[model samples]
Target: MSMNLIEKDRVATINPLKTCQPLGAMWAVTGISRAVPLVHGSQGCSAFVRYCLSRHFREPSEIAVTSLHEDAAVFGGRKNLVEGIQNVAIRLKPDFIGVITTCSSEIIGDDVIGFIKTAKGELKEKIGEEAVEKIKIIPISTPSFVETHLKGYDNTIKALADYVAEPSQPNEKINIIPGMVNPGDIREIKHMLRLMDIESIVLADISDPFDAPLRPSTTEYKPYYPKGGTTVDEIVDSANSVGTISLTKYAGSGALSLEKKYNVPAELGPIPIGVRNTDQFLRNLKKLTGQDIPDSILDERGLLIDSMADVASRYLFDKTVAIYGDPEITSGIARFVGELGMEPKLVLTGSKSQEFVKDIEKVAKETGAEIDTMIDQDLRSMEVYLKDNPVDLMIGGSDARLMAKENDIPLVRVGYPVYDRVGYHRRPIVGYNGGIQLMDLITNTVLEKYYEPEHWKLQQ
Candidate 1:
C-alpha cells in the first residue's frame, strides 16, 4: 500500500492544481437553460473567468459583472448588484440569474442573500409582479480563498436544489447529478440511461450548451443562447424522482440534500470511469428501478474486457502511471489503470479531502501497488517528485503538460480546463464505451512513445 500524504506548511505555490471557486459556480450556472452567471465583484474577476471558460469550451461564454467600485467596496455592493441584476434581467432577459460572490464581495461581508430578496421586490415594481416572478434569482457564496473550484460547483448545485426542488408525488424519473465532468461524459451517461429505457432528469445538463452545434440563420434571426441545459421545471420536478445518483463524490451535495429533504434515495459515486465502476453504477440503477442489465451494455462490457485481455501482456500490464486531476476523477482513473494490470505510482489532487485518501488506500489494496498519494499539493511539488521517481506516463488535465514534457513521459489528458487541445470535452472517459476509448488511448500512447518506430517491421 502507498502513503497518503497531506503536504503541509507550504508558504508559496507555483501553478496550483485547481482554479478559484467562483469559476466553478459560474460553470454550474451555465448548465441551466437561459441562465446567466452574474459575478458580484470587480470587472477583472469576471473577465478572467469568462476568458478561462471561453478558452476551454471554445464557445462564446457570457458572464455579467457588478463592477464594484471603491465606494461600493467600502460601504456595500447592494446598489451595484441590484442594478446589475435589473440590467441583466431587462436587457439580456435570462430565466435564471446566479449571483456568484467573489473574494472581494465576500471579504467585505456583503449581505448578498438580503440583497437578492430586496432585488426581488424592486424587480416586481420595475418589471411587473408576474414577469419578475418568472425569473429565479439564486445567490451562491463562493469565496475563492476558502475553497477550490470543486466546492464552488458543489455549493451551486446544492443551492439549486434548495431553491428549486419541491417534493410532490413521486414520479418514474431518476435524478442524475453529473458533477464536474465534461459534456461528453454527460452525453454518455444519458446514452446509458436511454439504453436502459430509464427516465431521468439530469441536473445542470451542459451537454448542449457547452458543445453546441453550429446553425446558420439570417442576421435578424440568429440564436443568441445555445438551445440546451436542464430546464427549471425539470429541476423542480427532481424532488419527485424515485432516486438521485451523483457521479462525482466531490459534487454530491445536491444529491444528499434531496435525499435528506424529500426522502429520495441517493447513490453517491464511484464515477463510472472503468469496467468495475461502470458495473457498480448500472447495478445501482437495476436495484433502484428493478430494471435488468440489458444485452447491449453487457456486449459493450465484454468487448472492453476482450480488448484489455488482448493488450495486457504486451502494452498495458505492469506499466507505471501517475495521475492528477479532481479527486474523484483521479481516483477513478487510478482504479481503471489498476484494473488494466498497471501500477499506479502516484495520484495527486489539489482539493483537500480525507475521502480522497480513503479512496486511494482502497485502490491500493485492490491493485496491490504501493501508491504514493498527494493531496492539496501543486504541480510544482509533482514536478519536483518526478525528477527522482518518474513514472512511465502521466494522466491529468492540460496543465500537467509541463510536468510530462519535463519528465519525458506520455500524457493522457482528461478532466477540467483542458484548454491545450480541442474535443477533449466531446470525448468521454466514462461508461463502457468510454472504457474502450481510454484503454485505446493509453495503449496507443504507450506504443507511440516506445514501439511506433519498429512498427514497419511487424507483419499484420
Candidate 2:
C-alpha cells in the first residue's frame, strides 16, 4: 500500500465501475426471447456498448443502432429511429424490440415514445398494418446522466412488463427476478426451483443467451437474435403467478411492479452468493411454495458445511479481504467473507443509494464484519482506502488486479467485467453448490499465497 496516495474529490469519478444505463437496458433486452436491444443514438455509442458486452460475456452482443448523426442530433432522431425499426423488423423479425436512449438523444430531447409511434406507422406503410403484430417496439428513456446501468436494466424490464404483459387466469407460478449475476447463477436458481417442483418464470433470463454454446456448422443461424430467454407468453403469464421472489433489490423494481399490479406476494432476498444468502433464498421459496426442502439440496448444504469446517475454515480463517463491485454482489461477498471467518476491511460499490447502503450496513452488522464502505464511489476511493488499510486478499472484477499487484496481495476475481478470465458466464455463484464453488475459489486463492516459485525449481 502506498502511503503517498492522496484523497480524491468526492464527486469526481476515476475509473468508474458503473457505466451508463444503456448497457443495463441492453442486458435486460438480451433476456427477452428473440428481442433486439436497439439504441436510438450515434453508431459509436452502440459500438462501445457491443464491444463491452461481447468482451465480458464472450458472446455476440447483437445490439442494433439508429446511426444518429449530427443532423439527427439537432432535429431529433425520428427519421433514423423509424428506419432502424424498419430495418430490424425486415432483417431480423424479432418478437420484441427494446429501445434505450443515449446521451445525445437525451440532450436533444428526442421523444422516443413519439418516434416509436412513427415507427409503427412506417412498418404499416412498408409491410402492411398487420406487421405491428409481428414485431413490437418497446422504448424507455435511459439518458446516461441520470442513473447507473442497473437502473437502465430495471427500467427497461419494467417498461417491457408494461408493454407486453397482460393479466390472465392465475397460473399458480413463481417469478424469480435475479439481479446482475452471470448466466450460470441464473441457471442455478432455475435448477433449484425445478428440484423444489415450483413452477417459475425467470424474468429476463440470460442463462442460455449470454453463454450460448457454439452451434454446429449445419445448424441454422438466427440473425441478430439468440435462441434463449423468457418468451413473450412467459412475461404475460408471470402476472398470474402466485408470488414473486426478487433475488436482489437492485433488480427487484420490475418484479415489484408485477407484484403490485397482479396482487402477488413479493419476497425480496439476497443474491445467493454464499451459504447464508442461499439459505435465505431457499427459505423464501419454501415459504411461498410450502414444499419440503429437497434432501438433495439439504445434503448439498451439508457438503458446504463439511468443506468449510475442514478446508476453508483452516486456511482462510481470520484472513483480511477487500471487496468491491456492484451493490448486491459486493454486499453478498462481504457477508460470505464473514461466513468464512474472514474480516472484510473494505466493501464498496459504484452504484449506491440510501436504501442500498443501509442494506449493506445491516448485512455487515449481522455478519459481525467491521467494514468501511464507499457508496456511489469509484476505484480511486477504494485505492485510497486500500493504501491506508492493507488486506491479505482482494476480491472483485479484473480492474482490481492493479491494486492487488501493487499491494503484493492475491486477487480472487468475481462479478462483472471479468475480462481476464474465461468460463465466467458458466461459473456457479448461487445456491448451496455455488456456495461450495465460491469457497473453492477463496481457499484456493488463499493457499496459492504459500506457493513459492523457488520450490518449484527443485522438483526436477
Candidate 3:
C-alpha cells in the first residue's frame, strides 16, 4: 500500500479506465420501471452512453439527449431543457423521466430544478390532465469532471431513496442494495434470496430488463420502460422491510441513508465474490430472517468447499496474481483468492476511497499474503506497479487488456465496461454457484498456462 512508487495524477491521463458520471446516472435510470433517461447536455455524450450500454448489455437503449449547440452552450440551455422534457414526455409518455445533467449544462449555469418546475406546469397544459398527473421528472445533477461514474450511480440511488421511499408497517421482506454490478451478478443475489425463501427488494436491478430475450415478445414500446426493473411501488416497499442489506457502499449508500431516516436496521457487506464473503452475506441474511439454512443451499456450499480443496494444492496454492476493478469486487476477489492460498500481490481500483484499502488490508492479513494497494488509480499507474511487482495472472475489465499484454499474463475479464467480451451481463459471479463459476475460470486459466503439449508428446 505504497504511493511513493508513482507520482500522483498531474496533467494527462493515459488510457483512462473510467467513464463520466452521466453515463452511470443513465445506467441507474434503467433500473426504474417505465422510466426514461434523458440527458440535459450534448447529444454526443448521451450517444456514447447509449453506445456503451448497448454494447455491454447487448440491448436497445433509449437515452434521450438535449443536443446542446454552440449557441446554447454560450448563452444557456434553458429552452432546450424545457423543450427536451416536453418532447420526451409526449413521445415516451414515461411514468417517470430521469433527467441527468452533463458538463455542458453544468458549465452553462442551466438551472435544471427551475427549468423542470416550469416544465411541469406547461406539461399539464399541453398534455391531458391524466397524462401530466402521472408523469414525474427527476433531475440528477451529474457533472462528469467532478466525479467518477461509480459516484454517479451512488448519487442516483440516493435520489431514489429521497424521492420514493415512504413509511409503512415493517414487513418481513428485506431490501438489497447492489452497487456497480452487472445483470448476472444481480440475478445470483436474487437466486440466493429465493433459495433462502426470503423475499427481497433489489434496488436498481437490471438483470431482466437489460438482458431480456430478443425473440420479439412485445407489441409496442410503452412508457413501460422495459421488461423488468424495480418499480416505484417496490422502492416505496423498501421502507417497510425488516432491514436493508447493502451489497456495496458504492451504490448502497442510499440504503444506509434509508436506515438513518426510516429507522430500518442496515447491514453492510462487500460484493460476494468468493467463499468467505458469500458465507458472510448469507449468514447475515439467515440472521435477519431467522430462517433455517436449507439443506439444498448447504449442499451447494459443501460442493464449493470440495472444489476449493481440490484446487488449493493442484492449481491455486501459492499462486501470485494482480487484480484491478470496482472497489467492492476488487476487495472481494482478494478475499476469495486469499482463501484459495493465493497471494493477491497487487490490488488496484480506479475509484477513490480509503475504506477500500482497509477492507483489502484485512484480507491480506487473513491469508498471510502481503499486498500493496492503490486507490484513485488508473491503468497507467497499474502498469507501473506491474513492472515493479510482477504477478502470474491479471484480472480486470477490457481496459486492462493492454496491461496484460505488456506483462504477457492471462487476463480474466470482470467488473464494469467489459466491452471486448460478450455475455458478461449474463455471467454469474456471486453466491455459491457463482463461486464455482469463478473457480472454473481461474483454475482453468492457470492450468492452461501450465499445460505443455510438447511434454505430453502424443503419438503421431
Best by lDDT: 1
Ranked candidates, highest lDDT first:
1, 3, 2
Q: Candidate 2 lDDT, tens digit per residue, 1-460?
A: 1011122357778989799889888888899898898898888888998888898899988889998888986788888887888888888888889888989998999888888888888788778887787677888778888768888887886786677667889887888887678998998888888888898888889888898877654446564566689998898788888888888887677777877776778887788877888888888888887887899888888998898887655678779988888888888888888888888777777776666667667766776766677777788887887787889899999987887889888999887889888887688878888888888898888877854444345446
Regions of candidate 1 where Cα sits further than 4 Å from its true position: 4-6, 218-222, 455-460
What residue pairs are clashing in model 2?
A: none
List per-prediction Cα lDDT, in the order shown.
Answer: 0.89, 0.81, 0.82
- Tens digit of lDDT per residue, candidate 1, span 240-263? 998989998888999999999989
For model 2, state the Cα shift of residue 325 in Å. Answer: 0.6
Stretches > 4 Å off in candidate 2: 1-8, 217-223, 451-460
Worst 10 residues of 3 by lDDT: 1-10
Candidate 3: misplaced stretches above 4 Å? 1-11, 220-224, 454-460
Q: In candidate 1, residue 310 scores what lDDT?
A: 80
Candidate 2: residue 14 Cα off by (Å): 0.8
How do the residues 414-459 of candidate 3 rate in per-residue lDDT, one tens digit apiece? Answer: 7777889788778888888888888888888787776554423432
Global Cα lDDT for candidate 1: 0.89
